[model samples]
Target: MLNSSFDTASPSSMSNMSGRWDFGGEKEPLMHRIHAYPAKFPAFITQKAVAHARERGVEVKRIADVFCGCGTTALEAKRLNTDFWGCDINPVATLIARVKRNDYQKTRLEHYLADILRSYARRHRLHYSPYLKDDRLNYWFDEGTILELSRVKAAIDTVPEGKYHDFFLCAFSNILKPTSKWLTKSIKPQVDPDKKPVDVLPAFEGQVALMIKALNEVSEQPGKPTKKAASIIVTGNILEMDFAEPMVDLIVTSPPYVTSYEYADLHQLSSLWLGYTDDYRKLRTGTMGSLYHDSDFNRDIKNLNATGYGIVFQLYDVDRRKAKATARYFADLLKTVRQCVKLLNPGGMLLFVIGNTEYKGVKIDNADYLLSCLVDEGFCEIESTKRAISSKILTPYRDARGKFTTDTTSRKVYAEEFVVTGRC
Candidate 1:
């Protein structure tokens, strides 16, 4: 059961919010970059949002990230010594988050690292018979490279129950994209038609080395994140979580950008290695549908009331470079907001780190739409800040003429993250 003290009703009188403030900051290194993710909001964005919640006298004893990609929100929460929990449909991502937030004994980590290395030295020279008949594999890597990756997977699968199992699994997950033919430019698994990719074997070994170094640096830090009191990563869809009533204190999350990138296909290599999905086409169902679909806004409307979670959207599909139909978009967005409200502990605050998207040459005012959802749902607006999208690492494209493009027609997104809060 959730604590009752934090579940009080909202203050009767509240102010209607109209504008935004500047909240630009730097990104966190080490973990967020363990592997590339196309549009992960910076750690600084989450940190500042979390800090803003603290200033309002909101007793954020526990934080929940519904779409806990790469574990940014949970990790920052752990660093601050706050109890944290999160869920995601992607198993590989959940695995990485679980490993990053694991409470490992320093001595045990050293022992586990040494054992994996020793095992690799003995069996690293062996070869593996390819299990999946993915022709794309040959296009991206040579025989030697694939065999080595097989060996790495074999070592982890064969390990006995120990503290390093999750750690080892994380090390394996980190190498998925880096060792593939995909460009490091986007977190998606994009095959560059212009260039022949590197062999997987050498890339696999290199990523393993980098993983070890990152773990070493983390181990050396003064105070590391131990495990959370309660941790969970649901493979089931977030829309289908089996819960009744508001059960969380704080909600921190960044849902997939409106029809921008396919999280599943981008990480397909990991899915293949981990034995999750064999068909790449299957990944689309888990992602926000793209603009090219024949149904367009109609498809979203079908999913709106079905989701049961409140997520407001004023987004332009950058792929087609146009704003989505507002009725269908807001309906789904309202459902997401409603889910957030139902999941909250009465007056619990919800934090959204969303950005504006340009669609069909028009900006979809997502922040304003979110505020409207709060008002309709019987929630009170707390505060908000808009930050210039300054972090260039996540932005990685230039038009044919070498100019920065803002329209969504060519799949371009300019940085403009917004922070919004409201009591449920």
Candidate 2:
């Protein structure tokens, strides 16, 4: 019941591909620069996928991204004047995505910025009582830095409730890491003990200006405005949310890599500062590929392809617990794929942008497994394209044990990723 076609082109064959297909380019859309979310695929990828769908005569109307991290696909859909719906378990990610898609009046944003600045300047000696009082907070920031950040929060509280409120809050959220001891370039939340923190007010002000510029650009784009597109970004786990019926026209997303990035830990600054969660560690439990659990692996992975199981078994020799975790990751992804298929209408496309990575000493062929799983789910026609990733927010190198590493000598993983597309 599966129809599969293979492309056996060697790496040399892909070398002449267009730059738009390559994720390594330096140029990125201004709107996408709102936040430095780890593992975010470039906007051009979505653009190309949509173009290909049009060529195939698929009329695009409603687009959904179940694992919409920071809303890349949703934003692209908005630009094309398509109705968009997206969900992510990470509250911080949902917040950024929601704000990015909002079409705020430029004058109103400027007025709010002036008022917030005036309110912050009026406070001479702000107390930090309202801020999160976790030990991790103190560890990441000095007392004076914390106090200044409190002033910023206090000023943001003055903004009236609405999109403006969230807009300013997102600006404040963007400045948290730059004004803290967190390592600026590291994907993982590692503290640079000797690094000096930037002034929260100036950093926040600069970020607000950048956001406004991006917002203005979106408003001026041709065709129907983004606000008229009926885009909705919600905070919900993809596995639990019910789409109810086959309504979506297209599904474009890049699910989290297996045990690669701890999203909760990486976003602790935003989570604590935005009051999305008081306990960052607790947020990890709901995420896929979470290492926090020790439960027995699900033995019956109905749709996981042979390559997936083979990699897990290989990892078992190095570490049984890790292998079990890998097994659990694939099982969860399989469930998500099935749910996505339910929501997609007949002939709709599911484009998955995923990368292969190593676990311990074994290579996990995520692309192959994903293709196989989609075929098993009754996707009629399957095609995939590979592109070299010259740079990404996520570190490319990992240690021998599959842990993210900064050392140059560490083995490199995930230099290339595949954009696998399947039609229902």
Candidate 3:
């Protein structure tokens, strides 16, 4: 609340955010890293959020991540021996989240792996699926690579429809980036011309081995969840979901960014190969902060809250497109907050791990906007602090096109994000 206005403060240019709320205990579990996701916060934040809530006398029975990207909260809730309910708009995200939440028997995984290997061995790629003709797939995958990947997908499909089947598909999905012409560790997908990728079968085998190791690590832990600790993960926008009752005790999540990475674009490879969609852009529909919305700003501007209207008005002076996107993001998240309030039990806490961004020098104060929204919803005990993000796979910078990059010349991503908590 700088100068009684959020726009008064400039965006942080430092590599570290305030260095205040950056806290994590012990090493992160292997399962959290089995798949790469855009803007996945450190796993320990879930632990810290739960602890903070409990310390404040909130008895957390079931945890929830409304925007559950890669199931960090779901996995940590199981580790804490609690129930979980999460949802996401992206099928690719829910796939990884579901796989991470369930416990798999090593014997079953090994048995399925053996059969998949045999199936892959016997598979002769004499024929291709008609979907193989997708131009995007051809642009990112070599001919041989896509053929072998399709065969692997076919073999995994033979494992019957259940967690194991999803497990094998997830294994295949993680290997997609490494085994394709898609450039390594890039948010923006593009073909790597001089690269030679690994064969699909061995990569799948290694992925399963790593997953097995992760499972073993969890199985060996003492305080792991019992069968009663159910995890309910669904695929849909939270804004569109029906919440007739308060189901969650504590909500810990990093909401979607404003005009940032399009998740559908990032997961195009996995989304295509898994048959979730032929055109990934369709996945971006109704997603919060997505640039593609069939909306009339003039019609929508009447409903904008004070914080939203302020920022969007400033952004409109610079760039109308960004202003529209920002307006949409604010409206969606405000509605999302109302939904979150409905989902949380009375006295339950909602902890939002959000950050601020800039567009053409106009500040996009997501944290401030969320703070205001929460207050409007009659939340109490609200507090916020900056949390420094530290990880090898992360860089606090993005190019003009919103692709993650290390170029200092690009717009600097907040080295730290705000953890804003309020009790419903």
TM-score, one value per model: 0.77, 0.91, 0.92
- Please, what are the lDDT tens digits per residue for candidate 2 over residues 1-424? 2222244542223223344467433355598998888888888777778887777777778898888888888888887888888999998898888898877988999998999989989886666555646788888988888888888888998999879999998888888889999887676677788888888878998999899888877777767552577888888888887767887878889988877788999899889887888889978876887777554666633334676777787877878777877787887778888988988999998888888876545777777777767767888667767777876438766765445678655545777788777788
For residues 242-277, write the lDDT of model 3, one tens digit per residue: 998999999999998977878888899899889898
Superposed Cα deviation of residue 296, candidate 2 (Å): 2.9
Instruction: Report the C-alpha displacement of residue 127, candidate 1, in angstroms.
Output: 5.0
Score candidate 2 by lDDT. 0.79
Least accurate 10 contiguous residues by lDDT in model 2: 9-18
Clashes of each: 22, 0, 0
What does candidate 1's lDDT look like per residue over 1-424, in tens digits? Answer: 1123223423111122223334335435475566555566667655666676677666777788887887877767766667777887776778777766666666765676566666666785575556435666665555666777777777666567543686677667666555655665654445656555554445555655665666666556676547545565555566656567667778888766555555676667777777777765565563443323234554554454312122223233233223343434455466667778767886688888766554444455556566556666777655445566656545434343323454335444555566667777
Candidate topping lDDT: 3
> In model 1, which range of ten residues has the least summed lDDT?
9-18
Q: Which of candidates 1 and 3 is the stronger one according to lDDT? A: 3
Instruction: Note the Cα lDDT for every prediction shown.
Output: 0.60, 0.79, 0.83
